[model samples]
Target: MGEEAAHRVHSRLDVLLAERGMTLVELSEKVGLSVVNLSVLKNDRAKAIRFSTLTAICDALGCAVGELLEVQGEP
Candidate 1:
């Protein structure tokens, strides 16, 4: 079997939130996700995210998935 690729994915949730003048609590209410879960994502510590959650966040923030997540350069 081939080994999976190693890549670091980071979230721009904080930036987007700031740009939109929205708080994490507001986003949580809109997306129905807890602040702790969103914080993990915002801090780029989350290992996984559900498609539904992604869609909800995008919808709530009026951003595309590409705008929310970015792949970090090789380290």
Candidate 2:
């Protein structure tokens, strides 16, 4: 499953939230996003994320874009 797995982008949202002692509910509220949207991202099912949303999330999490999103595969 090397190639298949490589194409998958895993979300570290859960880890970040836990590390910061924050919950998805809290993040969603702070970022002005719905829990469903955040949950999809957290579950690694989001097909795409807007730049604004990413910025807001990063800001709310006090993390950089690199810390939030990562390329899983070697290109």
Candidate 3:
């Protein structure tokens, strides 16, 4: 696999936000997180996330962890 393919984990925050008709600013407020931090995750640029942060985001979005993140691989 190529180097890019090696990174299979992807964030689905954008999709979830869109489905809920929410914006990053709104999520930041609800989750008590900075917009900059959330943007990192939403754009899939974050290398890691704290459990508390994840839980907060999940609660705000009304989504499971699995729904917020996904693994994609070549068939």
Please give the lDDT score for candidate 2: 0.88
lDDT of 1 at 39: 99
Give lDDT tens digits, candidate 1, residues 1-75: 222246478799999999999999999999999999999999988889999999999999999999999998675
Each prediction's RMSD over C-alphas, in Å, is: 3.3, 2.9, 2.1
Cα-based lDDT at residue 71, candidate 1:
91
- Which model, 1 or 2, shows the larger lDDT? 1
Better of 1 and 2 by TM-score: 1
Q: For candidate 3, lDDT tens digit of each residue in 1-75?
A: 775557777899999999999999999999999999999998878878999999999999999999999988754
lDDT measured at residue 61 in model 3 versus the true structure, 0 to 100:
92
The CA lDDT of each predicted structure is 0.93, 0.88, 0.92
Badly placed stretches (over 4 Å) of model 2 are 1-7
lDDT of 1 at 60: 96
Error of 1 at 1 (Å): 16
Off-target runs (Cα >4 Å) in candidate 3 are: 1-5
Give residue 55's error in model 2 in angstroms: 0.3
Best by lDDT: 1
TM-score of each: 0.89, 0.84, 0.87
